[model samples]
Target: MAIPPHAQHDTHATTRRGGWPTRRISVTALLCALSFIMTFVEIPIFPPAPWLEYDPSGIVAFVAALAFGPGTGAIVVVLPWVLKTLFSFNVWGHLMAIVANLALILPAALVARRVRGTRGLVVGMVVGGLVSLVASILCNLVVTPLYTAVGIADVIAMIVPILLPFNLIKIILNCVVTGLVQRPLSQALSA
Candidate 1:
């Protein structure tokens, strides 16, 4: 089926921003699959918080963003999440992961496209990452309490510390890895 004119126009506009072809799609898919695999390579930081395990999956999506852009990066983000919920239906964790990822990945993608150097990139992303982290936390803290009048205070206390650093790490790692990889990949992409 033919894409509608408006859709075609939008795609062409995005292409004008930065273009990619079939090989780029293949490269992005490879990275997305690698990200899903990396989810299994988790380190449990603690015990009772079974819902919380550290993973480096975000880095791969960041690579996709750097290689392509935000639209392509979003494609990979959903894939791993769907695969995870299929394997084990932890609805709460999966939902949280999805929300948290949307909260985190986008700004990082925008930043990834513009980042220049390792150290400078690190500082800039950390600042931007903090903005995302705080916004999400405040939204959660305010809204979560409204619904559950119980020890919402305790929930915030428990979650905020863990969440803040996790987000910070996610952005920093994504930015650093994207910065390191993008230049070399550009050579392949330009060809």
Candidate 2:
């Protein structure tokens, strides 16, 4: 049988190239650059731990994952850290940032994938926040000692008084900012 005239062209041809969508690749790259730039704009929410600054870069990654997919979100999260590593000697800090971001974005993206609408995103953020909180604490216990004079006990001592609230605030801020922008940004991108 002969193919119909309308069916002769591959519908995906314009959207994809070399096993991936060209538009998606471009969009991911743009988001990565934005994320990297946002890293510079950090705010110290917790005075007790001024180093635990909050940056909106994670919002960019979370939105990317929510709009595109978890893989894209993961790339968006890590690329900024990789770029920072080139300029800064803080390898452990970069690694912890990557871990915390992936912990936040991955669960949300996965949950959003399984459940549709805002409800899914919200549920995922909550779960992601909890996961990130624990991950940050554990990471501090391991990585903080490597870079700072703080031992495991010192890190543990800081967790409740410093780390816990800091992570919670950061997670909430990222989630709220992402929630505000995600739908509008997704619509704009699709348009």
Candidate 3:
């Protein structure tokens, strides 16, 4: 099948010496910058865990993945935290965010790449959202205790009451926001 218009390659774009095209690199950088800036603009959702904040950087990464493919999207996912780690030295949370965002974007980007159209997008997002939820639960099980004073049992207890719902809400919001902007972003990039 022909590639969707949104997936169409930029004909004039140069990938000199077989490297990534300038446009792709620029877009990835822009997305990473946006993600980095977004980290500071978080909102606390659960009162019990006032420290856990929701940042929509994942949505920007997801849009990059959807527009450029999952592998490139994965780079976009990691770049912000990699940059942040340089200054903050907070490895655990950044690592968790990397895993969570990758899990969130990959399923949707891979599926959408194969299955075109609106239905495909919705299916991909739903599958990706579920993947994010489960991966986050597993990641929290392992990573939370290492970083926080809380134990595994406490983390487990918080899963159903806090983590599960919070992750769901986060992914859903990312999905909605990405769905709104990805098409236009893709089209503009392709142009």
lDDT of each: 0.62, 0.87, 0.85
Instruction: Give the TM-score (vs. native) of candidate 2.
Output: 0.90
Candidate 3, residue 169: how far the Cα is off, in Å: 0.7
| TM-score, per-candidate, Cα-based | 0.66, 0.90, 0.88
Positional deviation of residue 25's Cα in model 3 after best superposition, in angstroms: 1.4
* lDDT (tens digit, per residue) of candidate 2 on 49-108: 897888889999998998889998999999998998998878898899899999999999
Q: What TM-score does model 1 achieve against the real structure?
A: 0.66
On residues 1-191, what C-alpha lDDT tens digit does candidate 3 reach at each position?
44345334543345323356667778788888999998767898767667788888898889889988998889888988899899788899889888888988999999999899888899999999899899999999999899889899999999988998888888888899999999998888656
Which candidate number would show the highest TM-score if scored against the true structure? 2
Clash totals for all candidate models: 0, 0, 0
Q: Could you tell me which residue pairs clash in candidate 3?
A: none
Query: What C-alpha lDDT does candidate 3 achieve relative to the native structure?
Result: 0.85
How far residue 78's Cα lies from its native spot in candidate 3, in Å, is: 0.4
Full ranking by TM-score: 2, 3, 1
Select the stronger candidate by lDDT from 1 and 3.
3
